[model samples]
Target: MVTVQAKLIFEGSEDKQRVLDLMRRWSSCMRYAYKRLLEGHKRNELKKQLQGIFNLNSRYVDDAIMKAKSILTSCKERGENPKKVVFGGRQLFEKLQKRHINGKAYKKLQLKWQEKRKGNLYSRGDRSKKGNLNTRIEIDEDCTRLRINVGEREYVYARIQPGWKIKDGRYIDRNQLLEAISICGQPYSVQLKLKSGVVYAYFAIEEVFPQPAITRANGVIGIDTNAYPRHVAWVETDEHGQLLGYGRIPMPELESGSFEKKEYYRWQYAHMIVQMAKEKQKAIVIESLSIKDRGRREDFSGRRSRRIRHYFGYRSLLEKVKLLAKREGIEVIEVNPAYTSVIGMLKYAPQFMVSKDVASSYVIARRGLGLRDRIPHNYMMFLGRLDVNELEELKEYVRKVVKNTYVRKKQLREIGRVIKFLQSLESEAERLSVPLDGTSTGSRGKNHNLWQVLKVAVVTPLSPERVLRDLSVLKSLLVSGQVGKTYKGASSCFLGQGLWLSQIPPAGAGKA
Candidate 1:
């Protein structure tokens, strides 16, 4: 199923007011549903509460609460750590449960949210932003128009102007799409959104999709993402995991850009990579990574800050790739990220004379192909230091971050301090090599290089590598404010919770 979203423009004050009234009522309805959830009221109990509250159909309220619960559930799944559902200013206007298109009963509308009507008519709290009528070019639709069927009292929306500017860089008339929908039957869903008096619409169409057979025949293409020096390293192999080809894809543009602009570019990048996989007739493999944090304490440095922002874009990249691949009938695989980088460096990099990222890509591909127990003995030593003094030192730093006086907003700088300290600690470890055979006492100080010791004592149990991995989780916890007393006492309110942040003067704000 492919979902297409479009921007909408409305004509005439009556038409605009009609859309606004629908949005206002819907928002108010969603707020009510959210409050009921917080109060531990079941759907049936909430349904009863809705019966006498609004003169509108009961299905509207039912849809509101379901959408609210669904949104809340998704947020929780993303590790949002939301203590309460905040229906702040943003209101929801979902597709109605029963809709009528061309007089046939269906579920949804061409346009649709706020609440509370005095008597049977919708109360106009404020209408000072009404505009002047003039000859303006506006996009509108009729056939695909949606009507809210409530017995004999129908709310009909025919044409929504300024339609959608699709991937072709041109506005697609809703009327044209509606004709197509009529032929193809009703879509899966049509969503309405109202923000700052601007209306937006989304249409999701379900179509026949063929299952990807590449994974069954060809192996996967593994991609390793490196943020510090931005690049995507990819390795291609057979279904059984023998490497076939490898290359580094440079990501210089990602290093610096506005968040929105960068996100658009990230989508473009993911699209390009997926196109490569499609052409090769192979499934793609990537690490299952999610970094839902602001930044680590170590991000105070300009370079560290850039790295955090760059890596954060990985989530967006992954999402875009998955969506694009699904639409194209391509298989995408995500494997655990445990030791791909380390294993890549220790086993593949030296053997193939490739960069760490390329080697990591190979490891990621292999891991996806069922080779999980192939770690080199030298790297296994570094993994066995769970009870070492360095770990204690790391814990002390983490505790300091949690106990810091700064608010969550200021924790990035604190994380930077921890990162700086980790760098110094690494230097100290290099200075005091900790011995190779696990037998050198401090008084008998062996002056062997740490990585060199591991190489020569390759058969020795448990060794250390030259580079120390950054404690990313420590930074993530700090950035996400999951470590301490951030957001400990915010109150939840039901009324006036909606926010309209856009200053794009509401329709008629411009002197006509």
Candidate 2:
């Protein structure tokens, strides 16, 4: 469990009064230190000033400084103006600008605002001090209480309400406060938050994940997140790397929404996927995708690429899946997303009559099972037909076609990305044994590196020449009786930039 929330019951009114006073003073100290931090005061400079101004000793003052500096840092990270920021709710504070309330309503709002401004006490935990120093937990078999040391030898006690609560959804975790303190030395932070007038102690503990019961050796579920149609594609596969079943979960919410709304749906979808894995006793496989840096494709300058890159909440969704999977003892495997889309489109989509996204998930699942893909012999033959110098010729021809025959704005933007994608493949081919054609006229080696096969595979599937549409012709032409039967020494064909990108020879090719 990462957190434990148990109500505190004070023994006497005097203890309650003392705790309230400390809370008030602590809030003041933190607010003052926060202002000082805004003025460029260092922690050491503010620490001495805080101790002298407030009744808090050096340790308490230091804690206040830590908390204040964190808030200041948060404001910087989130692009919020620290000067105009309200300690209480910003919305409530802004209400006075337009006279939003009066009389009884105004009094009610004022009370709430004041409560928020001065209703908290926090003490960071220390491992050497056995979990905590200021806010300490004392547990006997019969009784459990919080010992809050105010100063000198004086302290106040708050008896914790004893009972078991559900932890991490299903696990019954008690205030293993005793276990954490005496045995694990797992430091836990405590914050005394006051609501209405009663103080509640909120403890944040390090979550413990269970040992996985279901593993990748049995079976697995592969997941892929998309932005355009807005759905999460999942494919179930057995340990032998064969597809068993698949489904597409609607994610209309990811199209456009608030961060909170998107997060809620991410968790919701993550839970559904994890539950399916548990029911089938299978592991979960996902592409290790990041929002900002999605591996080699980061340099694509297309609008659709940039928008899709930023829009899909891939990282957040993956994190939630991993965390929940760990809690339920479900194993999760992450595979490189580099060419999953192209493989799915070129190989699986035609074979299974599935969407490109679903096909991609299938590839991801197979990859997680330690399966590798070899370039189809015909495709390898077509690659062998093109010499190293022909790389530049083919790229120029495709660029002219794209410029001459464009369609939708979004389509054009995406196709423009293919131009850069080809360039990247070009760069990857250089200065190493980066195999583009490992055929009998082998440029590099007899064996194909996945990335090398990827170089040629990536060029055709994603653009105007849709691989899914031309799969049959592609098979008949490339997979016919001979390796280079149809496309070999092909004459220049009228190839255009838009859809139906018929492969054409570069001008002056016959001379070459």
Candidate 3:
């Protein structure tokens, strides 16, 4: 059977005082029962049974009494009348049954007590002269609205205007009623009512329904998140782990010297990447960064630092991404970012060096770099050994290959251009004493740079002849000093954006 539910709101301080007094009296009754049992009274058998009941009932009485005393004390401390108290009779009864005694006799005893105190129980004092108890209590579907009865030969039941049916069958909390003086605190799932200019609402106590599950697909996408161009890298993979296509989209530039703008763009980029994932029918895999207790330095300092700490809202963005992915039936997975930039570079190194000839070579090379291996360091160390050299000639050659990788080169150019432009704009703005538009300032000029870079990186050599040719190009670029410091800036950008990209897609993909 469906449970019947209703909510009652107190009218004034007198009503509250009455309820508190009742709870205190109830506590006193339990104490008296215990004393009688200890004293070996004539009702010794009854007292013995009541001792068990009193022990169980003491908790409820203590809780109710404490709440009542708290309200009255607060009113007294503030020099206000203690006339209104709100308590759930049904909830109190249920608690008693669950915690104290349950059976026909206990039920009868409860009914008898309520019947005996029908009028004076909640309306005993002068403050209740309006006679609200006789009229105001209300019952409605899912306990959304309340009805009140006020005196003066008039009914004063408070009624909440009906709205949408309560979703997920939850009830409001009693504390919510005591705290909510305005409608803003009302439960979104249920409507509320107010009497004497005070509002009270209730939310369902039941657990919410689980979110719908999403179906799985064979398509997979590797998302490399970055700052200047939020969704910096995207690679589509087929069922057999073949790279079908890959691309990167540059994000709008965030105004320099504006941390808030930077954070806002972070969220925007994350959202756009999630959207892109949905559109492409691909599952997303992202690098996970531990935001809490990760010992990361704050981007801002002083009061600005405090504001960034309090308002950056990365947690909220993560929640949004998860929700969006859930709704769209796309899968999102997180991988450790500890060495992603380095690993990705190594995997795609050959393609960038020879442009078109080494594409297939990198694909085969990357197949062995998966972090899922039981021994990640062993694998990484192996890759490191391939390019490690103390000799200047060999060292330069390896560095060139790593730098020439399609993603690395493109990322380096993007960062250099963006930083240069931002620094230049900052200098100009300082001179002019003007601020640039926060959303309009970044390295979005190279629209096709990401795709071009990937295309250059993915071209594999079909034969050994091509591999040798690509290796020669790698050696030349390294020795000639054509590539500068391995672009660490892009790695930093990816770290920042990775947090935003990790939560995408609605379903879990099969093990990679």
Candidate 4:
């Protein structure tokens, strides 16, 4: 099933005003339903309450309650502390925004609020100004126009364009009203939204057909999603796990400054993935990543801003891809992500001449194929002798080093400065030479503090070789410019123009 938007044209100012009034009423109904739900009222009871409180049709009241319940349920499922539902507030009427317009207008105040590029929550319309009406609106018998029954024997007829062809063959017109939206199969519900002054009707087209059940596939495409420098590294492999190809799809919205664009691009990217899977006739494999608590961690607090940009939709990609895949008759599989990245980096990256993420994607594909398990022999041996605490300590040290070197370096200049700082810190420590005190003091024994500033001190067991390797990784990251180059005075950022392909090495080449 697919849903498309069919915009409606309101001919007169009064017609537009009437639709706006309907939207306001709808918002009020949603607010009422939400409050009742918070007070422990059941959905059916809330519907009954709305029928008495509002003069809208019974179907409209029921739809309003249903919308509110969906919002409340979604919030609870996400483990969020649902606050008092407010119309035109920061939460943006999660229910009201999506209430059944039933071929009516929906205020685009929230969308405009987002367009300002300001922070979330902006006022577009007052609760008193917006009204909502669901029923009494129907497409004319000829399907060439809409007949909206505003009152007894009183109807507002809006003429609409039949259809307009877009550049990509997708029909969308914000200015012209659409008369009839050619749909495939049967359209179950037609929803309308009025924002600003334009009206858009959404048609939920439901098509039933005999779907062929897919047998076991011989290959799968594995996708590894990264938040920072957002992208999905995908690799295709045979059933036996031998890699056939690899690539990466950069997602610019992960870092896009606009919340609206972030949402739009997220779905756009998901659709692309689903289309790719459909074209290839292969199943999709992805990690069941859960980063709900990522922002709460102290280590992640520094990136809170960037994280917030995409966090709400971090899991949305998976859900969307799965949904589209199901509709397309494509199978999607999830596999354990533990150690896939580690093994991919250490064992497959050099062999395949790909990035760690790409290599991890390869491993993920193979794991989904049930062809790979157990760490390599040497890795297992090393793991056998390492104590749990020692391993954790080493992991922590590496984490701090990488975090300081890569994440912190963004505050300063290129890798050269980083290497210089590490070397100078080492020199300062050597000059002190007397088992420096608990902490190393700077030039004035206080000012230009290296330890505090760098978030790392010249502790023992550090080496130039290690710093060099870290510098090398930092240099590669800087060169790649994973976030993409930014342009001033531009609304959209150029994303992922570069393409990566596996460069299989010679037969006798050294394979790490």
**TM-score, one value per model:** 0.58, 0.64, 0.35, 0.54
What do the candidate models score in CA lDDT, each in turn? 0.52, 0.69, 0.38, 0.52
Superposition error at 280 for model 3 (Å): 3.1
Q: Give the TM-score of candidate 1.
A: 0.58
Model 1 misses residue 474 by how many Å? 31
All models, RMSD in angstroms? 20.9, 8.0, 21.4, 16.0
Q: Clash totals for all models, in order?
A: 25, 2, 42, 15
Candidate 3: where are CA atoms >4 Å away? 1-143, 146-216, 224-234, 245-275, 291-313, 349-512
Q: Using TM-score as the measure, name the better of candidate 1 and candidate 4.
A: 1
User: Which residue segments of model 2 deviate by more than 4 Å?
Assistant: 140-143, 162-166, 171-184, 208-221, 225-283, 289-317, 327-343, 352-355, 366-407, 413-512
Considering every candidate listed, which one attains the maximal TM-score?
2
lDDT of 3 by residue, 318-396 (tens): 4555555655666666555443443243334433442221232223222323423121222212211221121222223
Q: What are the per-residue Cα lDDT tens digits for candidate 2 across 302-413? A: 6776667566677777888899999899998989887687677656765677877898899899888988765554444444334444554445544554555433222334
Top candidate on lDDT is 2
Give every collision pair in model 2.
Answer: 401-497, 402-497
The residue-by-residue lDDT of candidate 4 on 21-88, one tens digit each, is 55556657876778888889887666766766666656566667776788788888989776743444
- The whole-model C-alpha lDDT of candidate 3 against the native structure comes to 0.38
